[model samples]
Target chain A: MRKNRSPKPPEPCLLTECMQVIAGAWAPNVIWSLRAGPRRFNELKTDIPPVSSKVLSARLSELEERGVLVRHVRPTSPPSVEYELTALGEELIPALEAIVEVGHKLKQLRGYEPASEAAE
Target chain B: MRKNRSPKPPEPCLLTECMQVIAGAWAPNVIWSLRAGPRRFNELKTDIPPVSSKVLSARLSELEERGVLVRHVRPTSPPSVEYELTALGEELIPALEAIVEVGHKLKQLRGYEPASEAAE
Candidate 1:
């Protein structure tokens, strides 16, 4: 009896491990929005208009827990809060850019309307 | 009255669109497993041992529907079947590679065990 033990690419688990990092409702969006710089909670809302306050709040906390981002509290007249990517989080930008590139092609192939608002 | 409409990076939506492609249980694993070449159903199951047969089957169909892969049937004795990435699907490789790159860093920063089984 032979068990089919053919060689497997080692990336399955690694890819999955990373995928989990960006794997929540609007998690990728949050990261993409912050790629430029830090932003307040309301700024994130404007950046991703579709995300609800509840989901955004949860995703922000999760990202902080993962060390992908950090929250800074400014001692302003009213303690203003902002979120920014850690160095580790910055590493994800190239990955997200690659995804956006494919996204353009996928949109074309799938016959979806091109996003008129793409900043590029 | 000022409505904060600061210049926002436009990639948030694009990133979300692409993330949808790899968003599912073992979806990225299926793509990563097939990256080297085509494989049969059982081979995929073998490549990702933790994936259930049901989830694997479902992921295969979903990927097919997304045009990330193609299904081929061989007119062999028992009519064997294989699946492979299409050209568009091949485009996702670099994206996944970038993600894997970040995965390594992320694992390190989080002090998680280096994936002992990494193919390197």
Candidate 2:
């Protein structure tokens, strides 16, 4: 779900603030899952197998609080909940991909594992 | 000092570890400063004015411990020290810039302050 296009100019040296928010333990994974568009909580947990329900719920809440993701509730009989990226959250895709690119490269440099893309 | 060029493919769905490591309060700033090359502890503190000495020291140590940076000690008359990105650390530049790009866009969407680059 990560967006991989677009190479923009060097940003202000002060962007560490953005990094701090997205750097949370489950934030990146949540962002990546949302890249495919909005999904229900169970779908998200399915896509990202390791995150516990409580932790995922907490992370979703935190991302919403940080303006990174939006949570929606549908007025169904039992109530359905969905999570999606807000404009702010979608904007993070490129940056997160950039980090992934670096991770891929580091893996190559360390002779560890090649990036999923490179392996394919 | 954030690297702005090079847009590679989207990485595996599991790069949150790298983000977590660099997402510390002072870590991004430290990475930005180190992008130009190595610097002494005091120089880092000067470039990123908000961080305290203890925090900077702790962040640098944390980054070094995470394999993102290297600390070098010089046997100067007064004992000098320097910190630089390890290969892994240097590799983070593009990803960091990517995050900055997202931040810039978010600012645009939210009607918040523009990225430093656009302001310049």
* A-chain TM-score of every model: 0.84, 0.74
Deviation of model 1 at A15, angstroms: 1.3
Error of 2 at A47 (Å): 2.9
* Candidate 1 runs further than 4 Å off: A1-7, A75-79, A111-120, B1-6, B75-79, B112-120
User: What are the per-residue Cα lDDT tens digits for candidate 1 across B4-82?
Assistant: 5456885566777887777788887888888888889888888889999999988988788777888999998888789
Compute the lDDT for candidate 1. 0.80
The digit string of per-residue lDDT tens for model 2 on B8-65 reads 2244353765666676677887887788778887777767778999999889877876
Q: What local lDDT does model 2 show for residue B38?
A: 80
Candidate 1 lDDT, tens digit per residue, A1-120? 335444667566777788888778888888888888888998898888999999999999888777678999999887878999988788888888988988887877666532223424
DockQ of each: 0.44, 0.22
Give the fraction of true interface contacts kept by model 1: 0.71
The lDDT, on a scale of 0 to 1, for candidate 2 is 0.71
Clashing pairs in 2: A95-B98, A95-B99, A98-B95
* Cα shift from native, residue B77, model 1 (Å): 4.9
Q: List the pairs of residues colliding in candidate 1.
A: none
Docking class for model 2 is incorrect
